[model samples]
Target chain A: MFSGLSAFPLTPMQHGVVDEVAFIRLIERLADAGVDSIGALGSTGNYAYLTREERARIAQLAEKHAGDIPVIIGISALSTRDVLALAEDAQKAGASAVLLAPMSYQPLSEEEVFGLYETVAHNLSVPLCVYDNPRTTHFEFSDELHGHIAQLPNVGSIKIPGVPAAPDAASVRIERLRTLIPSHITIGISGDPLAAIGMNAGCEAWYSVIGGLFPQTALAITRASQAGDTQQALRLSERLNPLWALFSQHGGSLRVIATAAELQGLAASPCLPLPLQGLDKKGRQNLARVLDELSLT
Target chain B: MFSGLSAFPLTPMQHGVVDEVAFIRLIERLADAGVDSIGALGSTGNYAYLTREERARIAQLAEKHAGDIPVIIGISALSTRDVLALAEDAQKAGASAVLLAPMSYQPLSEEEVFGLYETVAHNLSVPLCVYDNPRTTHFEFSDELHGHIAQLPNVGSIKIPGVPAAPDAASVRIERLRTLIPSHITIGISGDPLAAIGMNAGCEAWYSVIGGLFPQTALAITRASQAGDTQQALRLSERLNPLWALFSQHGGSLRVIATAAELQGLAASPCLPLPLQGLDKKGRQNLARVLDELSLT
Candidate 1:
């Protein structure tokens, strides 16, 4: 169930409030595109910026709108108690699996992180995905630590940051993790730009940012990678190089993705939470030009 | 208003609830020790682990027990809206100033961070202290960014990490910031181990961790430095070298600080929020030995 393409949607916010209508529409769009799983409240979803009430409602909305697509809800928070509470909410809202990132304010120690997963994993009814997103959560997981966490009960998958760019190096990286992680636990790849390489490198799934907006585009890469068509996957990924460049230039993907969603009329203007003005005029202009060139506009 | 020795007390918690009595006792200890200010909800205070309601009550308790000493509340949150709300609560609770760190799950851009300070600073009735805690917050601030933020009104101080180990280097480091920041805006140094060095290096204040619990000891260093007795200040810092080394070995100051407070019978055992174990048995033994040698226990 964890294998294949998992799309992370932006939980569109309008004027500091979750745009429930737009949010449901995003879920439906991903469902219509036949994505394997819908990752709601992932980093791109602005889950950390939201309150529990809003998050719980969003979880329900995702479940209601996702049709048969499995819903993986992000339950990351600073405190373990809060993470537990959010996990419970996600489970109640019919999440197929829950995603947990070591989202922190005080940079966490390894023991604390393991304890968090152990305690949360012990209590979970649904399987848990260890979200090793150093870019946002700022917690780097050692391979040994991931091995330890993967042994916890209800641990079903690990969503890792992108693999090495080179094909041989990417295979070696995943192979090392594979030796430690259990076979039941699927390894999914994030870092939208490198999704094709990671998937082609034997990742069971692509946990993508662009997949949330342009599922068809992301699927083209995912399906090719899955079919052992390495050339097609690489070719498709190269086409979106401009978008990936924008993501890097902007520091991260949330802002860039927000702009793309807004441009596509899928979300409101200034859809992101406060203090995160989506993209400046210059960035937007560049994005529009690139999207037009790629025929993704 | 943001000068001398500002003691940041822990908001002691018991079984996941704020230990009001113990928290108040810590506040009284700082106030009785004649600290220049009481910095409630600082990192040592575990501001990030707390809920908004927990934070608001902590702020009120801090103000109530602090007597005439000005109270500085840490109002940091992931969302700007929440930070603004927390700032309002702090002000309503009679805080002299509010401290904000760009604590993030999505690693923030420079503009997002500046906008956070700008928006929060504009709304604040009290002064705002820019909290540059890269160790905990994981957001690095450039000197140019500091210069840009310093121009915003109500930005009364910047709680910098620490200065260089060498006297000459420390002086140059603080002096460089002095040129960019407004003269009126105080440059306070944190990192408890280096507090004395920073103070002697011309830092206007010591935003201390140890001072939160051992106000008298920290003040001895602060007083010597304020008197321009660099030799005595350095000597005092050198004496506590064991404790500083423990903090480094243990990853950060909070857990070590929590252990010391617990040993002193000042806070409940395991006072830190869950997932942040105060210290393991081995770590505790090491800390206890160091505290005993320092005659702090």
Candidate 2:
């Protein structure tokens, strides 16, 4: 169901609680910017750290603000039962689709992996997108495995990290994957700024963390690429690339979301929960410079 | 509590359901051979392939057969909540301790890592052991972080894999950790055959999959080491080394468990789950030779 640019909004937190007002404003801005879909509580939204009730509330809030726009809820948990429960919650909250990450504790064999997806697919009452981010997962879904996952009845899309313009071996691998999966199944790209390039390389949708910080720029880039204006998309990518690099360099997607929230004046503190050290002073300064250059703050 | 050799018995499967009768018999045999502790549903136990109910039943059965002998439950799961629940169930089922692997999906930050342990520790009544097998989890617990986890109130032990032995640099790092944490926090060595050497190098527990099939030999080696009879322990280790090398050469711990189970007549089909291919004919034959030489059958 995902096409055009999808925004993974930072779940705004104020005083250790979901800041509903700030979150509504963030979603409203993306909707106004013509974002095709909004991903709730994906890695960019810090799904892992949120309590179940908090996550459900955020999904409901996104649905409320999204109106007719599609709200894809990130449905990653350590248990298949939990994932199914979350997917049901997302469906109940009016999510148009759900994104699932495999259980994280043990590296699952393909049989176990298929069983998990089959369990979710058979149970969930909405379109399912398999999230394949090996950086966080320490395990990549091989193209062959992805083909197997695609065979699941409810699986509608695949979300992979976006590739930069310069064709690396990894980029070539992505091209090979595009040729393998069913052409009808959506292939969504994560990793903002490179989203347009990934789209040019046959990805069906672009899910952006940067979209939360700079909705207008993200939308402009996405629309340009959709309208077959590669030159325009490239320019916007260039403008957003520095910030994307700065945020994603040190840790996982949490930093990207934190940076975006900071830029947009959404979250008061850019503090990430344990094990994830916050950006150093130099890193913050670098982000500030990027924001200043973009005239965003 | 795991002060000597620990045997993780394979959960025998017959036509896809847990062969409870075979499983209990295996545990009783291991106990009779003087195994110091019994581990249930470890990687060697084909845990990921088992359903939740099957895994719980295995733990419950192990506890029943264990009697006064310590039964350590492998409480590894994708979700922190599920793992905690498993830990609680394990405690209720008479398990002396629970083992936890890090939340698997992502390379967790040290804070998320500690948070996971804290969640499990706070929720369960029994003492917990942090299972740090990087070969499976694809993540390592750093020496500093290991010390921190060792200090957690309910954390009683650290299970580190025996491979990639502590180098000079690692030895210096762990020495610092040894100074920081309580001396009583048992260090359990996980890689088979290296168990004796690792135990000599400060590890308090030696977990052996081979022990399940050749309990007499496994217990003899462990007892010799416990009595501070290094010569005897070394002799047994030498005898077992060829078998260990055969099982570990291709598939590491999984192959060892499967091969040992076949020799023990515990499992009719010693098959590995997908993504992990089954051992080749030559590998199986080599494993047979080791089992025959050990007089395991």
Candidate 3:
């Protein structure tokens, strides 16, 4: 299953269609940086915004450009049937595994949530990673529910979203989760700001959004933290703090990261799907200054 | 353009597919009971759980069986492009208006929310209704934002969800909204339990879920309330309190209403999309007892 630093790339778009060439370039950069895995269509990738056909195309492009790196396609949907459908499509598209999130229109009971993962995992030939991001899904999974899902067949990993404001709390949460879940189930931490703390707390991987844009920086933090070099890891994370601060202020990093990519000329104008505005002038200026300070420009 | 009681039908499902036959029967019942309009693919319709193709097909069914009753199609999507696409399909299917909700994976700012309606309303030939349901969309529109949306060229109405426990508060909210928005832009109240109060408080229409299942009863309440027959309206609503209590307890009436339809032998089963469980045994027993007491079965 997905391990180490997994780059969750932004699905670059042109006129509401996925720009495959730009997407390929993004993936190649991650592969070139020696990132361990690629997660296409993750939340940062705007999985819910894209159409079904566009999603399939983006997964295919990510897989093709990933080379030897494993590609984990995000297969979150409102229904179990749609999740299963996307999982099958991901497997057929050569994805190494599929990430499942409990995205619901209605509030789901604990039993229903478990049924969603168990039913989808039962039908999939590829390994299934439970994506526990309550911020996006609005359905919180208790430690007891997480333990139940981990014991299910074909469930291989869990992508834990760290609490950005409290890195120490994230470390404590991951530590608690590690003890509760099966030993074989890999624990990967997301939330760019807290990745270092999660790694130091014994998370096996970093399922990262910014890594897709700055894989070198993300990889450096993981390598340093994993080698027990806490000082070096702290220094690297401190350098990234300016951008992380903007992410926190905006309540999300999608638009800020997209703006960062555009400002650095890595991609075209930072245009997201309509109704979702990209960074304003103030946000762009703030992001540009941070990128310059980090020597990333 | 829609006024009076508007029936919001449940998109009856057989396995994973929308059961068209059952859907038509549901609409025909509303038309026969003299409902003023029809809103298909609403929240009760499980619009998010359905595919684009299924949604389009359901709109066509609703229009066909609705006869001359104005059909307002629910056109909510995460992306503006998808919302526009669905809106166009709805227009082609002979819809009178389209309902738009600020449905996003990420929480949208007031600017983004306004832009969603402005962009969609720009291209639509029919009227557009702002569907402000924070519980489902998680994107709340302040009174200022609602006024902004109301001023859009093609925006004709706003569907306000009632505060179930406080019908007086729901009525006062509608009265405030009515004064803020254009006189021509009608304010309709949803939340079936409070429909009677909304009607009495001068709301132009009832965008109802239970009305789709029990149209005759819903119409009677509307007619009584609209004629300034407060006592009659209160008596009618009192008769339906048992069912309304269950709806309130569930936080939503979709599953309960679906169960009521099944209990009355309208649909085959009370199936929601996977991951959203149907009523448990206790809920079912409570619902059955209510239906029996109401003489609905």
Candidate 4:
């Protein structure tokens, strides 16, 4: 069910409530940009910060606004019971597949990680995509663990977090993973700046953060790289390097992306939940310069 | 408000509910063992896994059983809003002090971490102890950040996560932290194995996990070390080293402690929340043997 570029939008919030109108508009915009799918609650989607009820509302909004495009709703929680509950909710809300990350407040053992996916997978009729984003979840999936997870029932796709520092090494790693896992399982890549390299390496899809806000750019890069137009893909990646640089420096793109969205007049505020304040004054200046230079504004 | 050994009991759960009867018994046992204080909802207390309502109940139970001993309630949450709310509840439950960890799902900047404590501190009348447990919270407090947090209003103590690897280095680190912060702010040590080293280095208290289950052992170590009986303290610490080895190897003590608790017949089951399974057969055998050798059963 995974292919091409899947846009993951920021969960826009206004005064602590999810801004439903803005969220619907963002999904509609991504759908109109002709992306293959919409991921309603990926890392960039701020799934951890919101309540279950709020996340349920987001799933409905994504499906309502995404038109015919498949909607992959991120279903992550600290407990297996909560994950299964969210998966059931996602399925009821017309989600194409639910993205599962091994998120635990406590670091999970290998057996525990498997139990989480296996139990949740057993409950879901909709296909489950195993999301491997170590930066946020703090649980790194070993190549061996990936092999084990691939054999689980109802798990149809794998979203491999990109090795941004070394794309060549990532390509080699991706090749080995593909060889190890079942060919029936769709392999997708995330990490916006490195998506070009991953797509060039023959990964089937791009689970993209940047694409949610600027789908045309992400889609173009995926098409160029998949079509063997390395030059075009690299050029596009270079153009977005400033934004990627900000994401790297800040340790995450949630704040940077939200800031950019607000600067470009897309969102109401760049505010994240308190204790996670957005970029500083100097950061805002740099972000503004990058957006203006790229004509994103 | 902090001295000697403080016990942190695991929140016993049965059939997906907090076992209030078992919880009260655990607290009463700790008080009987003459622990300096009872820390409800410490890391072993499984504060993160519990709901707000469940946490409130635990606080009331802690106060009910902890007759004369002080009760230090752990108040940690992803948002400052929730943290404040929990702090208010902790105060109402008659807690002597509230332990606060800069708990964030996202990595926080130095400014944000300071703001979290400052904002929460303003609302909390009870003294706040800055809890620096990086392994669980994933947010490390540098010496500079510790100094900053110590200066916040109502902040009267700091719980420094002990570095058990290098006892000498940890002692030096503890000393430097003691000198950097105001003398009024009590310094406590956590991590069962390193508590002796921390106390020997002049840290006022041992925020002990093992103390909850085996308070006699922890208190003996504390009393011996605090009274300048290094040889006796070292002997007690060495006796508990096997359990500490399991904690160090596993990167956490939650499951290991739970297993030992069940083996000693304190709790009915070592069952942690689903997907966080307890020790395997080999681990259980090892833990049982250790407990038996120590005569803790």
Q: What is the C-alpha RMSD of each candidate to the true structure, in Å?
A: 1.3, 5.1, 1.6, 1.9
Cα error, residue A163 of model 4, in Å, equals 3.5
Best lDDT goes to which candidate?
Answer: 1
Docking class of 4: medium
Give TM-scores for every candidate, taking all chains together and pairing residue i with residue i: 0.98, 0.76, 0.97, 0.96
List DockQ, one per candidate, in order. Answer: 0.79, 0.22, 0.81, 0.66
Over the stretch A32-107, how does candidate 2's per-residue lDDT look in tens digits?
7777888888877768756668789899999998867888999877556567678878888889999987644445
Relative to the true structure, how large is the alpha-carbon lDDT of every model? Answer: 0.91, 0.73, 0.85, 0.84
**Top-TM-score candidate index:** 1
Q: Give the TM-score of candidate 1.
A: 0.98
List runs of model 1 lying over 4 Å from the truth: none
DockQ order of candidates, best first?
A: 3, 1, 4, 2
Instruction: Report how far off residue A159 is in candidate 4 (Å).
Output: 1.2
CAPRI tier of model 1: medium
From the highest TM-score down, the ranking of the candidates is 1, 3, 4, 2
Kindly report which residue stretches of model 4 are placed more than 4 angstroms away from their true locations once superposed: A164-168, B163-171
Worst 10 contiguous positions by lDDT, candidate 4 chain B: B163-172
Tens digit of lDDT per residue, candidate 4, span B177-258? 8777887998998878888877877788899998888888788899999899977887888887777888877768889988
- Candidate 2 lDDT (Cα, whole model)? 0.73
